[model samples]
Target: MSPVNPVNPANPANPGNRVGPTVHTTPKVPVASSAPGVARPRIALSTVALECPDAHELAAFYVRLLGWEVEREDTDWVKLRAPVREDGGGGTGIAFQSDDTYVPPVWPGVPGAQQMMAHLDFEVADLAAAAAYAVASGAALATHQAADDTRVLFDPAGHPFCLWAAAGAGDGADTGRG
Candidate 1:
């Protein structure tokens, strides 16, 4: 028995093992809403998971910005839930997982650096006010902004998010699209 190099999965020590992305043959379709005759959708998105060096710290940052309460947490993970709406319905949550190898991603991406896979968006009544609030809440304004109506801010983990104002919020542009 001998160790195998993952970069070279095929070796004398190990054979017939492949390591790479898997391809899906079937076409993906959107899930239909629970209409009168439509069957209930089997899948529902509960949370967006984030990886950071400190789950608790990242979660705390979101808690201040979104007014979400900590729902569940352990040594390596923390979950925060949005405040229950007036209608008494629950809200989607964000989960953070602490990874020892976590590296802050670069925004306005560089040639070969790690780029953020995704980012969060918050709709605000006033773009300038929103940016100020986020800055006061431990978030830094990003130097590279993509649009006039949308201000970009970076969280402690270096994830870039947008504070977007609607069409009539002074920019006169449609902020409906993400």
Candidate 2:
């Protein structure tokens, strides 16, 4: 018989120590963890999806408002992607899906009536200019004004969104909450 390999675990040469095959284990990495030395959870928002009666209408409103392009579109669903940065980093995506039973949220969200589940908030340099643009783009200004700094407007689909004047932005306006 030929000489047996010392590294082989089945070899009879070493009774106490034997090696068959090397097994490497990868170190476990945390999928969701808090920031290093911080107690708060670290999470990133990848996309903000909304449901609308007409996906194209809502998508077009946002596309014109945010200057984002439609990355994907169909009869049932549409996705709008923000422009990429100069460093080639990916931008946020906003998706709109068609809902046949979609109901427009009532303005000023009454508890007894159809309350708004959620709404979008936009920070603009000039609230007046932005509001004018939005109104010109088929968005109607809401009669109920919660704050002077914020201009609440309803999209063509009756979804309420706010245009807040950001501090140290294009044109400094009232720093009120929307």
Candidate 3:
């Protein structure tokens, strides 16, 4: 077989053995606007769901850490009450759903199963106390870099999250990157 056309060829590997030059074309389709004008669906960010091997266990862990109450519970889904302050603004609600084949994430460069992505920061009054409490409550200390004011923690189910003391507002100093 001869060499196919340098620019375009029906089959580069089997030139002349195949059909004519293959033409590449883009399909014509209408692009929809993501912005809302008025007719778009009244969509709003509501909740985030995390898949866990055991929804009950994970939900309990969050409730203990955040002091959030269980809003709803079922075999497959569990929703926790959103953390609200006296001022009204606060953290969002979290949900956990059972995933039969769920495998916890592993730290980057660590061998074995690993979590895909996880990083949640909680502002606390006492960073050391809170970190200690979390460690006592079943969360494992993933890492503690002196340069970063945040400490990485893994929930009982192995989901990774963090605890960060509010900057300049609490006794905890900003050890994280400025």
Best by TM-score: 1
- Tell me the lDDT of model 3 at 22: 22
- Steric clashes per prediction: 0, 0, 8
User: On residues 32-132, what C-alpha lDDT tens digit does candidate 2 reach at each position?
Assistant: 55667879865677678888898998999888878899999998889998788899997668889999998888866455677676677776888889999
Which residue runs does candidate 3 get wrong by more than 4 Å?
1-40, 109-115, 144-147, 169-172, 175-177
lDDT of 1 at 145: 71
Higher-lDDT candidate among 1 and 2?
A: 1
Clashing pairs in 3: 105-114, 105-115, 106-114, 106-115, 148-175, 148-176, 149-175, 149-176
Candidate 2 C-alpha error for residue 72, in Å = 1.2
TM-score of 1: 0.71
Name the lDDT of candidate 2: 0.75
Name the regions of candidate 1 deviating beyond 4 angstroms: 1-41, 170-178
Q: Write the per-residue lDDT of candidate 1 for residues 1-178, one digit (tens) a residue.
A: 3456453344433232211112345535555567778687588789999999999999999998888889999999999987787999977789999999988878766658986677887778777877888999999998777666778789998887888886577645455532
lDDT of 3 by residue, 97-163 (tens): 9999888876432435563454565766677888899988889987533234566678887777767
Estimated TM-score per prediction?
A: 0.71, 0.69, 0.69
Reference-based lDDT, each prediction: 0.76, 0.75, 0.69
